[model samples]
Target chain A: MISIDKYAYNSRLRRRDPMQKLVFAMMTLSVCIWAEKIIISIAVIFIMGGMTVLKGGTPFPFFLRLLLVPMIFLLVGVFTIAVNICENQEMLLWAIPFAGKWIGFSDASLVKSLKLFLRALGAVSCLYFLSLNTPMVDLLAAFRRLGMPKVFVELMELVYRFIFSLMETADTIYNAQNCRLGYSSLCSSYRSLAIMASMLFIKSYKQSKALYTALEARGYEGEINVLEEAYESHWGWYIMAVAVNALLVLFVIALKSITGGLS
Target chain B: MNENILETKDLHYIYADGAVALKGISIGIKKGKCTAVLGANGAGKSTMFLNFNGIYRPSSGQVLFNGKPIDYSRKGLKELRRKIGMVFQDPDNQLFSASVFQDISFGVVNMKLPEKECRRRVDNAMEQIGITHLRDKPTHSLSFGQKKRVAIAGVLAMEPEVLVLDEPTAGLDPIGVSELMKMLRQIQTTLGITVVISTHDIDIVPLYCDYVFVMYHGMMVLEGTPKQVFTQKETIRDINLRLPRIGHLMEILKYKDDFDLDDSINTISEARIALKDWKARYLKR
Candidate 1:
């Protein structure tokens, strides 16, 4: 999580308007899911990956590693969908006989699983493109501009600010415990973790109260009203986003017309 | 009008759980002057500060701003908070937003100022704290010293008449402490904003603060210039505080080492000048 945040801040696209990125990522994600075609999914993945690495200056290896994060879950889910019992033994492409049944992946199941896997990956890549290029603060600001609930955005802002402090505190506590041999044994490790967790909860509670007091001192009368930072944005980025998504849609339409549907 | 920008009269604060934090404390913070509230842990300096901004209503006393009692009404409190910005010690607690620029603009925006004016104040405050480079950085990405500056910038943008900082130098390094104090002194002098900081850093008191108030067990035990306050050595030590290191050294030189140096010299430069004069006098022998 920290690495992603760090990369986002350091990315060349960090100063770009977050709304444009949000629109582009969401549009591509929906297109990837809606097209339901393996080729389109692959195209969407490449488009987002190129945008993140080439334009945003995120390292290609790092982007590839981030893409692989969801692969394990996708493979497990796709495996369940691919392997199934069939009444007709001849329907199974590669099957084993099991108590008067055939259990294996058929050609249709394999295609469906492959499409689902790519679609999931493609959607994930779209989000990664957005997150890799835009800091959470910028994203939250974009959400506020999009008319997200005021309280929701404020809560996110506070949580985002305190997350680092909480992490630092947790690190300090863990180090203190380690120095005292609190984690010498597995049993003691569990004990120490529980104690730390409870301590963290209490500490955060007190911190919240203190934060409230601090906010009040600044004249926070119920709402966390802050000035929205102005970004050096132009309509050109939105236009480009729309034009790219239009091309994707046209490509999907042309493919559907040419192939006469997903099959 | 009175010279004091803020004053607390017989202020007492009792927590809901029956713990007394401040007991009838009264002190006047002079307008446009830097003041230090020296205290040990649990000295109720923070509680008293909250009372100044009307965050915690005193149990049985009045907090006067500019010789007029603070208005506790919602609208009045808002106006008062706008003029008396309070920067908490922990930047994390004070900076509620991840964005440095936005966090700095928070207090100013609450004042319902025009958009352009708000932007100007935020930019000016960032420049004042020497954090224009950090304006685009997230609060979490900043170092502790940078975050401290950002926190101060956040309050400074409000253009408050009196800036109250609770333990401003608490978690800073030695250089950070001096740098921050110097920056604050610059702000106080240039902006003419009355500044009050609560700290146990004895050395900085004489070097930076024009006047000092010593708090012990929620009561005001001493109030004077740094020189006058540090002269009450016995009382200061009884409250678990101490003279500045230079003052201690000068005391030893004058008494233990039989040097004819001034014992009241608390700051480094003062001790240096005093030792130079003593050497000049002793050269005749």
Candidate 2:
């Protein structure tokens, strides 16, 4: 997760407007989910993957690792959809009998599960394209511009800002405890961890008060107002995004007609 | 005649938990000069700073900005904050944004400046601090010194007339400490901004500050130029603070070593000059 955040800040495409990236990602995701054709799903995956890797300059190995993060959940969900309960052996690819009932994989169920799995993966790839290329600051800025609730964005901004500080504090305290032999035994480790947690709470509470004072010292008037991020506002990126999603739509339509609207 | 830009008159502050943080403290900060507030930990340096910018109202006294008592009204506070930017000791607390650009621009943006002007100020401040390269870096990714610079840039972007930094050199390395003070001194002279800092780093106080205020137990024990303050070695030592290392060494050389040299030198350059004069004048004896 941290590496993904690092890459998002370092990506070559980071300089592009986040709203544009968000739009392309959301549009492609919606199309991938809406159009249930397997070919279009596969095409969406390739498009998002290629954009993230080739244009954003994110390494392929990193992107592949991120994709694998969702794979376990996806496979578990798809397993339920692919399994079937049957009385007869008809169309049973593999059957396991239990308590006078047969559970097996059927061809139709398998095809349906494959389509569902690909569709979900395709949609997830679109989001990956956005997260891998846009830093959280830019995304929050875009959300602010898009009229996200002021309180929500402010909370997210502060939370995101402090997460790193809190983590670093925890790491330091943990190391300090370890050095003092406070964690030599499992019981001692638990006791030390509990003490650290309480200490972290007090520190964070004090930090929040201090943060408020600092913000107030700077003329903060109940707002986390910051400068709107500058980005390369290019018409070509929007046009290209629309063109790609439109092509995917056309492909879905053509596939449906060829298959006689089987889906 | 109004040389003092910020002044505290019999200022007192008590934390809610029945602790007297400042006890009838009074001091003045000159306009367009670098002032150092030297104190040990928990000696109310931070509380005094809070009073400077109206972050905390004094319990029984007054904080004056430019010969006027600070106005605590919303509009008045906003106007005051526009003129006096306070940079906290911890950059993490002061910097509420991960992006250096956004964090630096936060202060200026609060004043409702136009987008272009905010960008210009951010760019200019980054250039002043020589952290233009860290513009796109995340706040967490920056080193301690870089983060400190970014924090300073955040306040500088607002173009405040008085910059109050709490322990600006606390977490910095030796090189970073000198470089940061140099940068701040340059900024102060070049921009004519009043720089006020609170620190326990006694060495740099003599080197960089024009005037020093020594705080002990929430009371202003002494106030003067660096030479005037550090020369009172016993008085300084009474408050859990001490003279700068060079100043102490000069004192011992004069008293213990029986060197017939002035013990008032607080910097290496002054020591060199004083020693050379002594040698030229007394070597024949």
Tens-place lDDT digits, model 2, residues B120-225: 9999999999999998888889998999999899999999999999999998999999999999999999999999999999999889999999999999999999
Weakest lDDT window of 10 consecutive positions for candidate 2 chain A:
A221-230
Q: How accurately is candidate 2 docked according to DockQ?
A: 0.81
Q: TM-score of every model?
A: 0.97, 0.97
Best candidate according to DockQ: 1
Cα distance off (Å), candidate 2, residue A93: 1.4
User: How well is each residue in B127-208 modelled by candidate 1, as lDDT tens digits?
Assistant: 9999999977888888888988999999999999999999999899999999999999999999999999999989999999
TM-score per model (chain B): 0.99, 0.98
Look at candidate 1 and give me any clashing residue pairs: none
lDDT of 2 by residue, A189-232 (tens): 99999999999999999999989888888888888888776799
Q: Encode model 1's per-residue lDDT on A83-141: one tens digit a residue.
A: 98998988989999899988999999999999999999999999999999999989998
Q: What is the TM-score of chain B in candidate 1?
A: 0.99
